[model samples]
Structures are given as structure tokens and as C-alpha cells.
Target: MQYLFRLSAIYVRHRRLALAFFCLLQAQAAVAGDLFHTDNADLYSRAFAVVPAAISGDTQLKFGDTPPNLRLRNSLIIGTGAALVAVYGSNNWWQSGFGGGFDTTNEGWFGSGTKFGGADKLGHAYINYAGVRLLTPLFESAGNNRDDSLSLALWSSLGIYTAVEVVDGFSHNWKFSPQDAIANVSGAVLGVALETHPGLDAMFDFRIDYRRSPRSPKFDPFGDYSAQKYLFVVKADGFASLRENSFLRYFEIAAGYGTGGYDTGGNHQRSTYAGLSLNLSRLLADDAYGGHMHATAFQRGTDRLFDLVQFPTIGYARRSLD
Candidate 1:
């Protein structure tokens, strides 16, 4: 009886510590399992698997065949991409040409006519969407699950674009634009939505084309009206639910608009275009081409190559001066 009583006393004295130790074990197991499975599992398995293993000193747990420094690799990829954008794409913001004073005044809806009739806003949205979409696969390769990858990509794009806006605000030549910020957010949301439903990717695409304009204070791609055309393309292949037809599937419709002569003291001319476009991805889809035109390196290279050549389209123009 005395021995039993002593045993009970010991158990009571150590109860809290034992409970804490068990909880610690559970936490470690959960962390290990998440790390392991995120790097290895398929969609179905990732959704359902959460079994916690017992933590034994002799038990070895491996997080797939990934290097022990997977986090470092992810950081490097993100950092490199950010550095490139900051250095080349946004170098104008850091240059001494613009006065050093910050502009806190928000440019109501359309920024100081410098954005070339909302072309810059559309550019912002396109950047945000493309940034998130591009970063998502990198995040996934870096060990994040699909949901986490999408979240990270969205936040990362927002962060980069917000940083750009902050730099713009401080520049003497540019003021903060609420319209641009809204467009950026909208694009990020669209990117996340598309990523969650990849089937929708074929349905919508944001494309941009640029041409040199003779009337502009500076040759800025983002600000120059004479140089930018933003297109929202709807691919017919995206209508997979509406009975697949061979002829219609290879076509796309695009509506694009841009403006010029914003800074040149002339009337801001708007260019609206509507035209039939080819769905190169759908047209090239064949067993020989691996049917993954959207995901292949060859397809991406072709896209970049073709982007240099602006396709001809029929459009209407409003306002007189160029």
C-alpha cells in the first residue's frame, strides 16, 4: 500500500511536466510529418495525411531527397528575382534625376496624366498577375504545399509592387497613385484565383505590346502612352465545358486599348482594338509536342520570341493628335 501510495504521489508531482513533454513530442512529430509530406506527397495524399509519428531517438525521418538547406535555396531564388527587378526594371526610381522629396498626396483615380490613359494601371495589374503566377511554381519546388505556395506568391508579388510604389512616391517625378495600387491588388487576386483553378488558365491571358512614341518627355515603358498596348485575351479553348469544337478551339479573341500624347501637351488619344487572335498553345497541342505547351520550356521560349513581333490588328482611334 505504501509503495502504491508513493507511486501515486510521484505521478501527481510530475503530471504537468509529463503532459508538457507529451505535447512537445506531438509538436515535433507534426512538424516533421508536415515537412516530410509536403516535399513528397500528391494532391490527394497531401489533403488527407496528417499522421503523427512517435519520436524515437533511433528513428530517422527524412524530408524526401531534398538538401538539408532547402530553405536557403528558396531564399536565394526569391532574392535573385527581386534584385534583378529592383536593379534593372526600377533603376529610374533610384536615380538622382527626380527630386528627393516624397509626395504623400494621392493622385485620385487616374494619376497625373503621366500613366498614359490607364495603360500604366493595366501594366501594374499584368505585372502582379505574372509575378504571382511565375513565383508559385518556384515556391512549390522549394517545399511549400499548393495553398502555401499560392499564398506566398501572392504576398511576394504584393510586396514587390508595393515596394515599387513606395519608391515612386519618394521620387520627385512621380506621386503615389491609388489606382495603380488597386490594380495591383486586383491582379494578385486574379492570379490566386487562376492558380487555385488551373483549368481557367487557358481561358484568360493578359498580354502587353509596346511601340515607340515620338511625343514623350521620357522613354519610359510604364509611363509612355505611345509605347503600350494592354490586351485581355480570351482563348476559345478555355470553353472546354461548351462542347469542344476543333476549329473554334484554335482561336482567341482579344480586346486591347492604350493611349498616347499624355505628357506631350496634346490631346490624350485613346486606341481601342478588337480582333481575332490565334491560340498558339492550342494549335501546337499534339503528342509530338507533348500537349503541355503552356508548361514546356520550348513554348516559353517561343512566347518570348513572338512577343517581340507585335501582331497586326484592326482598331479604332479617338482624338486627333499623335
Candidate 2:
């Protein structure tokens, strides 16, 4: 009974925070107007028009048939509340790494000698950032406005991830990592900011690529730190000026970091890299490839996929920083 009550309380508290902040964002959004395309009369402004917002980098928004007779406040409350419930379940997920009591550990950040060579930190960030983007679509599909959906995604992500850290504070194997907390905040903020400003979102993508080392120990895919790389990608297609340049539109620039020989292998080293990369998303959306004036579902999927996973075959490594 006590355990159930505690679990219930967790959801209740976070829901309150979700509601409070969502209400505040609702006000701000009212002033800001529609978040995606500036002009509703634009071709893509129609519901799920399957058209990308030119070079602005706004993803396909499902501007739903939410009835105008319905008050925006009530719609927002119902929509955001449903999303929070789905993401923030009423259960104590803290049973893992079950420590009898509270504990602590000092895990340094990004040092060659540190655990997994800071891969876990980047992992934390990536998951949070991805979570926000992924969750926003659910609200959008449910007829929630872009502003409410995005704000809910942001607040729910932080509240849920932070709750995990708090639970770690009480566990035995893992102590709460302040560094992980900071990364969570950073990623969540980046996700919301990019969604807000499509131009900036156009120029950058945070991604992970994996190429297993020959000597790597056979650990689980995620724990196989030797095989993972984190990247930031800048796409030329994001610039309207480059769109007409047949060759340059698909060009990209990438920089990334990785670690080798860790996770039970010998001789660990940190690797940094720079490279020329292809914009697979733009390639699919191009007219020469039977694409249209705007992005299609297939093209949109490619863009979202590349946001997290970098396809190594399409990218060229210029040099490495050992």
C-alpha cells in the first residue's frame, strides 16, 4: 500500500509541474502565434500538407482540425494532460540498480580515463533531445496546438529524467550524477530551442554512429563504447541560396567524437573527427529524385532518422584528432 501510494505521488507531483509550466507557456504561445510557418496561407500551412517549409527547417506539422468553438485553454489542458500521463507513468521505475540504501560515485566527464570515455553523458543528452522531438508529434496528432505540445514535451522530459536521478540518489549501485542532470537539461533545452527556431535547427543535428572495433569485447550494443560515435551535422540544404545549386544542396559538414578499446578492451583512446557528409534527407526530397516542392512522408522520415543515427557510408572523414 505504501509503495503504491508513493508511486502515485510521483506522478501527481510531476503532473502539477507540467500543468503549471504548460499554462505559462500557453500564455507565451498566445502572443507568439503559430510556431511553424509564419503565413497560414502558405501551401504547406494546410493540415499535413507534406511540404517542407522551404529552407526554414520546420518539420511536417499536423495542424489538426481542432474546433475553434472549443476554448484554447481547455483544449490545451486536455491535450497536455494526456501527453504527461502517457510519458510520466504512475510507477516507481527506480527498482533497477537496486541499492539497499543511498550511495554515491564520482564519474568524471569526457576524460580518456573516465568510464566509457563520456559516452554515457552524450547518451543521456541524445535520449532527452530525441524524447522531446518524438513526443511532440503525439500531441500534434491529437489536435493539440504546436506551442502546447512542444511545451508539454519539454517539461515532461525534464521532470521524468530528473526523477530518475533522484531515484538514483536512493539506490546502491548508482548515486545521482549531477553531470548527467546537467546534460539532461542541456539536451532538453536544445530540443525545444531548435524546434522553436527552425533556421538554427536546419544547420545542426546531434547524431550517433557506430563502427565496431576488431578487438572489441562482445558487450551489449549500447555498452559497446568502442563502437559508438557522436556527431553534429550541418546541412547545406538548410540554406535557400544553396537549394538551387544542384551540387551544393546535398553537401554537409560533420564533426564528432568517439572512444576505442574501452568496455573491456585494452588500450583505450579518445577520437575526434571532421568530415564532409551527404544530406540524405535532402537527397530524398530533391526534384531530380522524383521529389516535390515540399517534403514527403518518406523524406520526412529520413530527416528524423538522420537526426539520431548518422549513416557512415554517406559521410567522408577528412581527418582524425587522436
TM-score for each model = 0.67, 0.66
Question: Which portions of model 2 miss their true places by more than 4 Å?
Answer: 1-97, 212-221, 287-294, 316-322
List per-prediction Cα lDDT, in the order shown: 0.61, 0.64
Best by lDDT: 2
Candidate 1's TM-score reads 0.67
- lDDT by residue (1-322, candidate 2, tens digit) is 9999999877666664454344334433432234332233432335343543363434433345443222343335434544453333222222232436656567888987787788878877876787677767655654557886787677656765665565566644467788888888888988888888888878788887877666654533444677788788888877889867989988888888877767655777787878777887777666455745235555555568877688864554534334
Model 1, 256-280: lDDT tens digits are 7776666566767766777577666
Best of the candidates, TM-score: 1
The TM-score obtained by model 2 is: 0.66
